[model samples]
Target: MKGKLKKTVVLVGMMGAGKTAVGNALARLLEVPFLDSDDEIERAANMTVAEIFARDGEPFFRARESEVLSRLLAGSPCILSTGGGAFLAPDNRVVIEEKGVAVWLKADLDLLWQRVRHKTTRPLLRTADPKATLAGLFDARQPVYALAGITVESKPDYSIEDMARKVMAALSGRHDVMEME
Candidate 1:
């Protein structure tokens, strides 16, 4: 079934919460465009997220991220997947609240670690104890993510499509954001 996306759907969560994967699936299911803020940042800077972090530092990258988010949110509504740290910033959160519906893809720490551990792409997990670092980030970010407009629990056994369906179900109740036919 297809539905109208009245506002952009912004997926926010820790790195390995399947924001990109599930956002892609959700966009396909809803017949809307799918945009990734990190990809936009990388494209504009001609650098990967890790490279941006390594060279320009996080504050610089974050500034670029907020700029990209503002640009995207000002455009047509779509499914926007953000970097792990994007939603933690108050300004970004305010922009999202005004232009999009934020959905926290809440996943347990163990599940997040399992998905992100083998991925060397995550700059934040490059620490000596990556698992512990991930746990720390999870602890610190959960409260901030809880401020999202909606929460979709992501379980270890759930496939990307399942998570997307769950997100759709969560959005179904918000008539201002979604309309099912």
Candidate 2:
């Protein structure tokens, strides 16, 4: 809580894993900017993420996501939240690896489903069976997310503030990533 971040703390995980929410709290705790790649993409395209996906398709959206990530990473260290699929791309991973510390907010499928089930903002979840799709994505992404520099587990009982503090605690010991003043 009393430190200068040494590099961007990139939050990577599923849509409902609290990347954006935790990133904002963590950035406030660290006294730095909080940036979300999807927000940036939406801003640039003048459309919401779902709109972009619906109109241009995921490949086009992903290309823009990579562009946004690169631009965000090039700036000073901050809390950066990425889309769920951003880390799946090797190029984005390489850029984040070289320029930032990736922290995966790991949550179980059930936890994710509970958080996202009522939400309509998620384009990927709009399917015949969104729960099944989420489960599939969760299974496919876990191994890749495990490659992150640090991992903070997400539990149903943990509030957004609690998750943020957990991320801060993980970063606290890594002086190369975040150094206490």
Candidate 3:
């Protein structure tokens, strides 16, 4: 259980991959605090994530994400859910790997599409062909997601609580492979 070993568990994955939900449930199970990078950035900038992307662009948002990551990591033993692109940054990946345990919440292409289908607020997904865009994004991010210390495969029917329990069990060494049923 890198969470127990490292004193923190950081969730990293693609958008709509359940980082926030799983982080919250994992935090509750572990009796720790949960922090979401998007929420933190919103608080810091006084704007929604979509607004930040629209008004300031992604570079600005990435900068804000880095700042929040720094602050969150400084406060050890917290359960943190990072933005989809956050871990793609080399420094961010290094920080999460060194300072905390990174758990990648992965879902199949169809499942991911289903989870995010209703969202028009996702700046990246606001395209003529969102499904194709999502597929491309998933392909591009798979390797980055794989670098996490643990991988949790998300099911459409499973609640965050179910995933959290599996994560807890995995971290506790009761399960191997870090893949949730």
Candidate 4:
């Protein structure tokens, strides 16, 4: 059954934290639309996020990210997955908090590394020592991510579905955000 969502659910966390995958499943479970901020940015720019970062630099990309986030958050409620750095910007955080509910998909460094180590698509992880960079990023972003409205712990044993359900469960407690009938 479809659950009613009064506000958009914005999935925030580190890269490879399953924001896209879990957000897709959460949208399915809720019977609502699923949107990815990075995908939207790519579509609008006619290029991938990595390309945007490489060509225009992170500052330009972040400016566009904030614009896309505001536009998306203004729409009807849905499950919106954001890039890892999207929530780090204070302006983005303010808009997101005003328009949607942020959910941090918390996972350990080892788990995040296991998921992203082999992936080349992550521009931030293109570093010479990505594991170290990822560790630094994870440590730095934890406090900002902690500011999210909800927290869903993720472990290796949790399938995408399990994570989605856990997110749903967290949302259930906030009557202003979700109400499953």
Tell me each candidate's TM-score: 0.98, 0.98, 0.90, 0.98
lDDT, candidate 4, 42-98, per-residue tens: 999999999999999999999999999999999999999999999999999999999
Give lDDT tens digits, candidate 3, residues 25-136: 8888776789899999999889999999999999999988988898798885788999889999988988877777788888889998988999887889988999999999
TM-score of candidate 4 to 2 decimals: 0.98
Model 3 regions more than 4 Å off: 1-6, 174-181
> Least accurate stretch of 10 residues (summed lDDT) in model 2?
172-181
- Can you write out model 2's per-residue Cα lDDT over 31-105, one digit (the tens) per residue? 999999998998999999999999999999999999999999999999999999999999999999999999999
Itemize residue pairs with steric clashes in candidate 1. none
Candidate 1 least-lDDT 10 residues: 1-10
Alpha-carbon local distance difference test for all models: 0.95, 0.94, 0.83, 0.96
Top of the candidates by lDDT: 4
lDDT of 1 at 57: 93
Over the stretch 85-112, how does candidate 1's per-residue lDDT look in tens digits? 9999999999999999999999999999
Q: How accurate is candidate 4 locally (lDDT)?
A: 0.96
1 or 2: which has the higher lDDT? 1
